[model samples]
Target: MTGERSVPKPLVLQDEDARGSRLKNTDLSDSFLRNLKMRDVEIRDVDLSSSEVEGANMSDVRFHNVRMENARFDNVNLTNVSITNANLAGMTIDGVLVTDLLARIDPDDDI
Candidate 1:
């Protein structure tokens, strides 16, 4: 038998403040972490795939080489966000396709 186990769900937190906390190498996959003030927290090497985040405020967050495929985002604000070296294929903003917009500037796209 394989030693594979399912990820456990997270505890529901309501009106809790966890700011100025340092978390390193934490595994929070398949967890339900929703609605609990988490501002200015330093998170490194954490897995947050398949996580549901709604009605939250996030500012000054930096991500590197994170996997976010098949993720749905609704009513979220991203001010001054920077995304680099990531796939933007089939992504649309205001009915404008990202791939289509890049195609216009790079016709041949040999660079």
Candidate 2:
């Protein structure tokens, strides 16, 4: 069965303070959000494909059913970050694949 996807609208916000704001039923595809800060924000059922976040602080943020395909991250500080039931296919850290290293350490990781 084929499912239809609803494309999100184009959004651009520069130097805007959207703290404690609620955004519902919106498409943020191809949006450029620079210097945006969000505290205690709730984002559900959102698509952030090809989005770039630089020089920002993110804490206490929760994501459900999110897809981060081919996403790149660099020079970011991460503390208390927990990832479960993830697809680490071709995922790398410090120019090394995680699955490959794990396979070597364990030789049979069936988890």
Top lDDT model: 2
Query: In model 1, which residue pairs have backbone atoms overlapping below 3 Å?
Result: none
Model 2 is weakest, by summed lDDT over 10 consecutive residues, at 27-36
Candidate 2 lDDT over 1-111, as tens digits, reads 369786555665666766666777755555565555556666666666666677776766676777887888898666788888888999998889988876778546565
TM-score of each: 0.58, 0.64
Write candidate 1's Cα lDDT for 1-111 as tens digits.
489896666666567665565556565555566545666665665666656666666666777777777676666676678778989976777678878887788556675
What local distance difference test score does each model get? Answer: 0.68, 0.71
Off by over 4 Å in 1: 1-35, 94-96, 106-111
